[model samples]
Target chain A: MKAVVVGAGFAGSLIAKVLGDNGFRVTVLEAGTETGHDEAVHRFRTALVKSPLAPYRTTVAAPSSDYLINTGPFAYSSPYLRMNGGTGTVWTGITPRMHPEDFRTADLGRGRNWPISYDDLEPYYRAAEWEIGVAADADEQRQHVPVADGYAYPMHALPRTYLDHAVASVVDGQRIDGRELLITGTPQARNGVPVSGYRPDGHLCAGYASCVPVCPENAKYTPRRTQKRWSPHIELRTRCVVNRLHADEFGRVTKVSYQRYEDDTTGRHTRHEVEADVVVLAAHAIENAKLLLMSGLANSSDQVGRNLMDHPALLTWALMPQPIGPFRGPGSTTSIDAFRAGPERATRAPFRIELGNWGWGWSAGSPDSDTAEFVAAGLRGYALRKAVADRVGRQFTLQFEIEQEADPANRVTLSEDRDALGNPRPSIHYGLSDYVKDGLLAAKRVSDQLFELLKADDYTSYKPDEERYFEHNGEPLRYWGAGHSGGTHVMGASKHDSVVDQWQRCWDHPNLYAVGCGSMPSLGTSNPSLTMAALALRTADHLVSHRAEEVRCTMSKAP
Target chain B: MDAFVELSAELTGFSAEELRSTGLVEQYAELAQDATDAELIQLWYTGVWRGQIPSARAYAEGLAWKAVGVAPPGTGAPGFGSWEHRPRRSV
Candidate 1:
């Protein structure tokens, strides 16, 4: 059996590995060049603005279509990589499983419900945690989501930063909006304690605060780790952009067409096609939708590129009364797990409050801006040095990743603009619904109360001219994309309402699967990477089992 | 070079020896001809000269991390569980 997986991201790499291990030939096609760990770290260090895409090089031939032309009221400014490892290379490595209630959000009269329940995915979730080498305490994590009773992560949980300790000291038992606030160590995929029998591949966490753009020590999980463990049957072709998929009248994917680029500098490329028994689209949510829309496949329900969603985050930063040692560890070591679920979600979106360890870097340009301000204020020498230390050391931020309900109006469509390969770019139309806006309002109210409880100086400010800025209830507000994009190719029970089935296989095509966060019906407050990995593992198992069944039928026919 | 280092010391509140210890004084002095007083100070603190970082070494040696009493992110491997305790220079 032969399989062609598009996009060498976490999902694609894992699926390719499983297929290769099962005696199937797998060809993994990636649109971008492979970036080495040292190269990425160097790029991040030299970058002027340390955005997520800073580490990876963007090629014209395989352009990261992150600069989407917006046709909606608000700008969808979330950027994703199109490199060999995909956006997984630049993730924060925080992995939290969705709550059981997250599968049935429609029951709360909000987002759509998932066709499969959490019980069906719980085992796979554990498998993904082991695959990704997640370092977390299953005992503590079960408080938020249901983890299997005896299951524990591959490694011990990452230590909470001093800032987290300080915050918990004051606000651990406080009640806001009738919900008790508890600061817990978030489950992260970065390496931690060294266990005897279950050692992760990479080195332990070395306290690099640059996990978003790059992890210098390779302590965080990336698809590159899985790619390193692939069997000889798997072939990875970088800089090959898959443009379309060809399906026969029987709705079986027969051909995968792509353009192989020579290099990024020259816009030179050659077209090629490969035949496969199965084709998997493991590209990021937007890219998968774009490919399906371009190929005119998997759109029987007119839902291939509709129902776009993202965890639109609202950030609130403040200065603590004393120094709490910000920017010392990972990007975030702890989160307020109180508001992730409740009865309030019926009227507004639920949110996960990630306690930022990197200080006000996301809110306002930090140590650099602090130096500039001190210089401008006529402070020089020792006074300037002392001021920056006092101020920046006390800096902290609360990132509220509010769950966005899927809306058909927020979508990705083919743009008129063409890339270097003459392929149409992804045009986005995104907006926040009233329910999400109410979520933002509720999050701000909670932030105010928390600030009061901690006696911290609130420095949160939203400008009117910001890109994602909007007016809600006569107050200016803004949101930043958490880079958790989903719902472009949603999964459902009925073929009339969704593009893919519960197995992430296309409803219209038997041999085609579009796996990733794109197949999620509703994104709960948790990060979607772990869930996407679980679904990919499940799909791989399904494909392997079905292939066995086919072999058995062939043998019986021969007899 | 000495004059540039002296000016940087006055603006950054660092002594001449400390500024020279970073080993970026000569490189920064060469780039300081086109910079304003504030930009020069920012260059020492941020390792950013005219919008671009000179090198990875420059970023790691940035004075801002020293001012805040922490190593620059992605450099100076602080080892596992180092963030749990208070920094030596906590205010």
Candidate 2:
């Protein structure tokens, strides 16, 4: 059987590799061009902003900017890179598992509950961890995340930075609400202690301190790496944008038509069609919803592009009373899960506090801004030396990504604006609800207390003039996107409320499946990539089993 | 120009031709802003290759100061301890 995957990102890459290994011919169509690690590194070195998305789109060509078109009261400032590896290429590499309480959000009186439970996805999560080469101590993780028995992570946890050790010392064993606070090492995709004898240029976190735009040392795992293992079996077609998906009278996806860009600069392209037995849409949350809505294929439930969700984060930065050291390790080495779940979540949103080791890189430009300020003050000689040392050493930042309830109003819809290939751009309408605002206030309270405990001077720059700013307890607070997109084409028990089934199969189309964060009914406090990977792997197993049953029934009919 | 290309080729494992193909010469020149590519590459060879950066923060601070024409002390030359301190190709 032939399988057509319409993305080359995290989910698409994993699903395609699994299907190829299962003896099905897999063809992946990527909308972006194939770029290597060298090009990404070159762009990163020269970038002015140093934002995660900055390096990927250095050229202002039409095809480069065709990916996202934001129209909103709140700007979607999070950079979404369109490349062979997808947004995973620019990810911060934090790989925390969703808590067990996350799956039963509705049962616990929080957000909507997922169709599948944590137990159902536990084995698949283990498989994903091994496949992606996650570096984490399973024992340590069990204290923070819920882990099943007989499942150990691929490698030992990464070494905690000085900043991490400092924060953990203060927060460890401390009780918040009802549960004890644990600041443990973050499970990351970046190399720490490699389990797979696979050595690349970027083998381990050499403390590049730049995991956002690109990891200089190829230590991080991207879907693009899997293409090497599954190449002979899987065929990847870059610059092939699958715009239209066709279904037959039986409501099964028969074929898909795509536009292939020959030259990105001139907007030149050729149209092609391909037939497949099974079609999977593994585009990121926004793009997956946009593609389905544009194709008009799986909208029988009218819930395809509704209920968009993201882990909306409130950024808080501060200065340590003493030089604890910053701007040394990865983007974030550890986080506090004290506020992830509790009795308080019933009236407010739950949250995870991510402690950044890269200092004020999330808020103010660290090292760069800190140094510039010293220079601008006209301080030179030994006085300048002492001041720069003091400021840079004490820099620290804390980011709280609060879980937002899936709301139908915040969604992705096709706009009148068309890209180079005439495909409608994804127009988004996203906003924060009172549920998230309450969570923000709770997170703020924790931040205030943590500053006092750590003896860190809070330097939170909450400007009152910004459009996205909101007054919380007389203090202006602003929310930022955590780049964890979810809930656009959510999955549920039936077609009445959701677009996909528990197995991520489209309820309207038998052979059609929509995978990725888009299928998540509700996003938990942790990053969504790990959960998305588990779901995709589970869907891959289901498809192989379903195909086996089909072959068995066909043999019986041969008589 | 030839000396800079030769030194970069020796240090970064990339041949002079390969460095040219990546357009690093042009990029390095642009980053140096006013300084020639030769001066910038020489600076990297002396500071980064010789291991002069005290810390990651120092490296970033040095680069930021250099952008505005201020050079941090204890440097051999103008380009030493700049942002383009790492080997052209880390891989």
Candidate 3:
């Protein structure tokens, strides 16, 4: 059998690996060029703006700027990289599984319920954790999320930062809207102590504190790592932008069409076609939706590009009473996982409060701005040194990543604007629902209480001129994209509403499967990458099983 | 460059020995051409010369990390579990 995976992201790479292990010839097509760890680290350090996409190279053939064209009230500013590993290359590496209640949001009088329960995906989640080499204590994780009994992770949890300890000192047992605010070590895809004979591939996390754009130690798990383990049967073609999927009369994807860019600078490319027994679209949620709309396929329910979602994060910063040793470890090592579920979720969306160890960098530009302020004040010598130490050492930030319900109005559509390959750009119509805004309000209230308990000086400010700024309940509010995009091509039990079934196979096309976060019905408060990997693994198992059954049927016919 | 280092020490509040330890006094002196004392101070602190950063090493050796009393992020391998305790004073 032949399998074609259009995208070398986490989902696509996992799917391709599974097929290759099953003795199928798998082809993985990527839109971006391969970037090495050292090159990315140099790029990140040299770039003027250390944005998440700073490390990755952007080509003219697949222009990163043309990734999204927002045509809505709110700007969808969550930029993704089109690289060998996709956005997983620059992810924060947190891999918390979605709460069981998160699967049934619609039952709580809001959002949409997932077709599959957490129980159905539990084993797959364990498989994905091992595949990604997640470092976390399953016992602590089980406090919030239900996992199999005595199910330990591949590695022990990464050590929590001093800032986490300081925050926990003040607010560990506190309550917010009847939910206890407990600081738990975030389950991350970085190396810790190996367990169950599962050793991580790269150097252990050496506390680079640059996990966003680049991990110098290669400790964080990116899809490129999975690609490295692929067998000879699996082939990876870089700089190949898969634009369209050709389907047969029966609506089964038969061929994959793409433009292979020869040169990175010039828009030079060659058109290529590859026959496939099955096609899996693991391109990002927005990209998958755009591809489906452009091909005029899998919209039988008219829900191909609808029900978009993201974790709109509200940042709150403050100064600790003492030096918490900020900007030392990972960007975030712990989070308040309490607010992720409760009865309050019925009226408002749930959220996760990430404890940022990187000080005021995300909010006020950190030690740079603090130094600039002191210099402007004409403070020199010992006075300047003491001021900076006192100020920068005590800084910390709390990021409230609120869940966004599936709103069909907030969708991704094709624009008249075309990329270098003449493919239509993804035009997004995104906005926060009232339920999400209510959740933000509750988060702010909880933050205020936590700050009061910690006795820290709050320095969070929301300016009206900001791009993500808005007004809610006569109060100035703002949110930034957590880069957790999902729900564009949602999955459901019935084909009447969702584009993909529970197996992530398009109902309109049997051989076509649209996987990744795009298949999620409701993006929970947790990061979507782990769940996306689990779903991809599940789909890969199904495809392998289905192929085996087909072979058996053919054998029976031969007799 | 000696004069530049002395001025940087005075402005940044680091001793001349500490300033020389960074080994970028000459490179920074060249990059800070015609820059005011304040601009030079900002360059030493933020590792941003004019509008652009000179190099990755320059950023890692920025005086700001010293002032903040921690190694520059993504630079030194501080070992695992180093962040669990308070950082020692770099200055």
Candidate 4:
């Protein structure tokens, strides 16, 4: 069957490839543009000072040439310009799988259950890891689950660094489970060890916070890389923002309409519409819910844009006696999961927390610029150079993104004001919940314990009270989301409380489905993008199988 | 919404527990449900989501006043510029 996908992020882009490979005609509508090295850099920088999306602004009169800034929820938060391949362009290339406990979060009464069980999607997740060329270790990965013997990992796991040893020195005997819970090294999607015949690009692991902005060394595996390998049946429409999904009387998606934000810096507008037998909403979490609400579909439960979830990133920092060469490797090389799996010092409920070894104990902006500031501070000329020197090799930072259980009252809504396309901008109406407070309280205590054990000097924290006092834009806004929001159109076994079924199909409209993190019920500690991609693969497989079943049934009924 | 109310009260130096008992959570939930645009509700909730709130007890009082049709006791009304800013967000 011919399928249309909205979004060019990890999920949408992958769906296009999978469907095309499976002999299905595919059209991928993306709300971003494609730029080569120099041009990509220009847009990336512009978005930093301006908006992450300045290349494709959808409107009625702008020509399809001007770069537009995406005002969509998660996409707007970073000002990350959407280019040809999507957000994968600047991703750190860290590939991880959701823990088995993540799947039963809600069911255990601890978190929430997915519409589909882990067993149902496990194979697809395996297939996706293979297709994306991940490098996870079988032994380290199966810590929580009974992973089958010899579970294949596509790429070789990256080598653990010395930083792990340093961290272990600090928390080696950390008490948990009547013993020490050793913080182990996780895997990365970056080419490790070396693929045979793989052309080497850059050094293995350079601490580049720019991974989210620009990977100058080309070590990242963005969707653009996958698109290049796809069959000829795949098509991409960039700089286009899908406006609505039109459905036929039988509840089948019939057409997809979008406005191309090709011109805006100067000002001209254009629009386009395409028809497809099936439509999948792969736009990131907030936008996915907004589109469903705007299009008047997938909200029979009236919960389409409710229960919004995101990782509450609390920057737990400590002033170190010496710096740990934080800028020497990938932004996140070593992490502390001493309290990642559960509540702090509590027996019943389990939550997740991890150490963050990126940037520095302080803010990490552009390296060239930040280094100059330090130099200007006379760090080298100061008599207390040793004081600054003391900061080296001794700093320990831990950023904990605690999971917030689902609360339906928190959600998204359209604003009175409209954007360039006259579509109401998504006005995020979210708040931390008591459940989150419980998690954060545990996180704070655990982090304090970690800091004390590491012998770190207290520096600063991202506590709620601190965020409240900080001010900007002449208003008091302190809510921070990881851009990893979800649960707007949650998946569940029944339609009474959910919009989609286990397979992500619309309960009211069987032919329609949404295959992104938006359907996730809870925001686990891990980033949801990789898992979102895996789900897209699962959805593609389901669509293919269902189509085959229909064809076989039709043939059997023939005279 | 409870997060925002508590956060707002915190900024204004109100007791956190008092922020909870003030029916702010219940009222905010009502506002979300009554909001016309599903997306706007999301934006409003971000304030709640991040626990970002106006650092003024008066802000909560103003919100309360708005709900009850009473005049706010603080400077001006509960205007957007007065309470709409996230820590890093610009006007």
Candidate 5:
């Protein structure tokens, strides 16, 4: 069978691997550039880019002119990764699964739920963790609350660092409303304690913090890493921007038209055509939806790009009277779900905090540095001693993963503007919902209390005036895109509401599957990546089982 | 930092309108407007502006102040020493 996978990122990459392993002739059409050693080094040099960089669809308040980037009838997101390996090439891997509540979010007093339940995805998540080579620690391992039957995580957990180890004494074993709420070291895709044997996944590692910018040590697994491990039957092509996907009369995707950027130029002379029996649109999220809309191939429900969502990142940091190697570890540390499933501890709302691994003010012109300098200047000439002392340990960053209620107005549609190939680029039309804004407020309330509990001076900036300068009339809201795009082309049991079935196959074109966050209708407390990876594997499994019939049953009764 | 800003002005040699058209103009202006990116960009801008560059430690610390917020000395809630955080597992 001939299958076409359009992305080399988490899902696309993995789908290619599984199909190649199953002995199918697979052709992966990646929208990104090269993924070999030299190209990886070059990208590391220049594309150490931003914390999040992609063509997003959101009404982002322009800091300069107050012009919002995301606005309109569709979801505006800054969600694209034009590299061979996809977003995994730029992610800091902290793998926390969506809670059980996340599976039934719509029923549990929130947005819609996935077509499949936590039980349905639990096994796939296990395979993903193993395939991704994640490491967990003691309490972290136990905290996963495993739902996978007869299977645990493939790799052992990494050790809790000094900071987590110390905090565990204070927080863990603490009672939460009469029930013990334990916060443990989180599972990470990076390496920690050494394991002797090699992983079947791909590559080896030496515990490098280079998860975001391409892994210099080759330890972290980008999808490209595994795609290479497959047999020659699988053909991998990079720099191939898939402009449109065309289908036969039977609703089967038959032809894919893409262009390759030769070099030092942005022209359309390098277009190519390939035919496939099955088409898997794994182009991350945004681009896939854009392609679907551009092609008009599988959008029978007219819901190609709606329900945009992302983990609104309310990033806050703190300074310890100590020194954290700041640059030592991965870009994220431990995580807390204490506030995830339901209302967090002592608060009546839901959210989660992942420890960021960046330093207080590593970047040159960030406000974080200004704040640090302000604090240091207050201390005057004593800076020398303070700097040395503070350099030894770590400062903590709190990354709040706030849940966003899916709004149809927040969507992705074709823009009048075209790319280098004359294909219409995606325009993001996104706005924050009161649900998320309220969630942010709830998170703030929790942050204020937590800082009080920690007894650290709360240095977070809260400027009412800033809101006046930032608020927009749409939704009459005062927030910007978290830059984490999702939802567009959601997976659900209802054909009326979603474009894809639970297996991420197009409702109209069963052979057309979209793997990525574009299929998500809800934002869970954890980062969307781990869930995306799990969903990718689940979709792959569905394809492997040849169970197209089951995909029809959950068309309206999402678990 | 001031010196670097001047140097960037010199390097451009172009008029204001020219710089305004570039994405860097928007990105930089946005950085200046952003409490976080502003500090980081300004430090890096030192090279483009006047030219002297600081160490990574100095650069990171400069951004952190604005990125993280602390109660001004005392909000009566708590002092600086007792804050708590859970560390993630080592990579």
Candidate 6:
């Protein structure tokens, strides 16, 4: 059987690997050009602002940033790279699994419950861990989340930096809101010690402080690694954007139309078509919804591009009494998971406290910008030197990824705005509900108390006029995006309310599978990549088995 | 140079020996010949990630912000002036 997969990110690459391994002829379409490791490293080294999207910009495979138009009050701060490796190449590589209770949000009266539970995705999560080389101690994970017995991580957790050890020693076992705040190693997808030298373009993490912007050491697991593993069985095409899907009389997706761009400019492109027995839309949540809406397919419920969700992050930074060295290890190596799930979640959202090792890099630029300001101010000699050392050494930041519920009003729709390719830009409307605001307030209270405990001087503040700031309890609060986007094409048990089923198969089209984070009915307090990979793998398994049965039935009916 | 080394070691909690290994001392010695206290602080951190600074731990202390010739937070210093000349970045 012939299968066509769109988007070569984490979900698409893994699904293609599975389908190819299952004896299906696979053709993977990637919108961006194939970005090699050395080029990315060179770009990162030469970039001025070392953001996550830095390495892939200005090149032929640049991200779709220049074309996007935001019409919402809260700008979509999360910028996505449209390269072959996709956003996975630039992620922080932290891979915390969703708590089992996260799957039961609706049952617990917090948010909508997933059609499938954590248990349903458990095996696939383990499979993804091995494939991605997750470094975590399963026993340590059991303290706050559920882990199956004998389900050890593929590699040992990366060593905590001296700063992490200091913070953990001070804050671990401290009670906050009736739960103890223990700083533990966050499960990460970066390479640690190898499991029997089974290296597939993988290397042990060497504490590169700029994991989000780029892993110069190539230690982080990107989808390019997945592509390498399955290259023998999969036919991969680069710079080909899947534009639309065509359905047969039986309401099954039979073919896909695409535009192959000659250059990075979206307008200069050639149109092409490919026929397939199975068509999978594994693009990111927003892009998947945009394509489906443009094709006029799989929107029978009028809910294709509704219910967008992201981990709206509220940031706090400070100077400690004693310097806990920052900007050494991964972007973040430890997190406080106390507030991830609990009874308090019903009224206010739950959050995870991610301690930044990059020292206010996300909020304010790091050592370079901080030092540059002093230089630009005309400070000279020892006085200037001392000022630079003091600020750079004492810097630290805390990021609270506060959860947002799936509000249908906060959605993605086709805008009147069009890109160079004449495709409509994704029109998004996003706002913070009182539930999320209360969570931010609670997180702020906890942060204030924690800083006091550590004797850290608080330097955190926000602009009053910022659109992200909201008046709550007569106090203004602010937030930013954590770059996690989901819920655009929500899945559910029924066709009336959702776009896909639990397996991510479109309800309106039999042969269409709209995989990726788009199918997530609700996002638990975890990064959506691992969960999306698990779901995509499960979908691939479902397709292969079901397709085999159909083929067998046809053969039996034939002479 | 010796005074800066001792101060950085005290603030960063790293010994002077470890600090010297980062090879920042070479740059420090060069800057010390002519650099003012504020300039010394600024130059050290500017080279922190580039392997000019001894260690990441020492860089985080940011004691230079309290040093002379630096403008107060937010306020730009008038060529080698104090923080009073510059607006504060935070309270």
TM-score of chain B of 3: 0.90
How good is model 5 by TM-score? 0.76
TM-score of 2: 0.85
> Model 5, range A188-221, lDDT digits (tens) per residue?
7765443445354543333344455555555566
lDDT of 2 by residue, A141-255 (tens): 8886678776667776777766777777787887766567878778988776655553432465566666776766666778767777784679998888888899876687889
* Model 1 lDDT tens row, A404-432: 98788899999999888988989999999
Fnat of candidate 2, please? 0.02
Residue pairs in candidate 3 whose N, alpha carbon or C atoms collide under 3 angstroms:
none
Q: Look at candidate 3 and tell me the lDDT of residue A484.
A: 83
Candidate 6 residues A1-559, lDDT tens each? 8899998888999999988998889999988876667676666554545567766743333346555567776776777778887888778788988888778777764557788888889998988888888988889998887788977788877776555666777888888778888888888888776555445355566555557766766678888888878946689998888888998666867789988877764468888999988889987888999999999999999889888889988899988765555555566778999999889888888889987766777777755676668667865444555665567666778899888888788788888976666677888887778888898999998899878877888988777876566668987678887778888888898998899999899999877899988888777778888888888889988998898765664355446
TM-score of each: 0.98, 0.85, 0.97, 0.74, 0.76, 0.85
Cα lDDT of candidate 2 equals 0.73
Q: Chain B TM-score of model 5, please?
A: 0.22
Summing lDDT over every window of 10 consecutive residues in candidate 3 chain A, give the lowest-scoring window.
A550-559
TM-score of the first chain of model 1: 0.98
CA lDDT scores, all candidates in order: 0.89, 0.73, 0.88, 0.56, 0.58, 0.74
User: Fnat of the models, one by one?
Assistant: 0.80, 0.02, 0.72, 0.00, 0.03, 0.08
Instruction: Supply every candidate's count of residue pairs whose N, Cα or C atoms clash at under 3 angstroms.
Output: 1, 3, 0, 83, 84, 49
Q: In candidate 2, which residue pairs get closer than 3 Å at backbone N, Cα or C atoms, i.e. clash?
A: A202-A217, A202-A218, A202-A219
Report how far residue B7 has shifted in candidate 6, in Å: 23
Candidate 3, position A126, lDDT: 98
Tell me the alpha-carbon RMSD of every candidate. Answer: 1.9, 8.0, 1.9, 16.8, 10.3, 8.2
Task: Name the weakest run of 10 consecutive residues (lDDT summed) in model 6 chain A.
Answer: A57-66
Ranking by lDDT: 1, 3, 6, 2, 5, 4
**Least well predicted 10-residue stretch by lDDT in candidate 4 chain A:** A61-70
- Quote the TM-score that chain A achieves in each candidate: 0.98, 0.95, 0.97, 0.84, 0.84, 0.95
Q: What is the lDDT of residue A220 in candidate 5?
A: 64
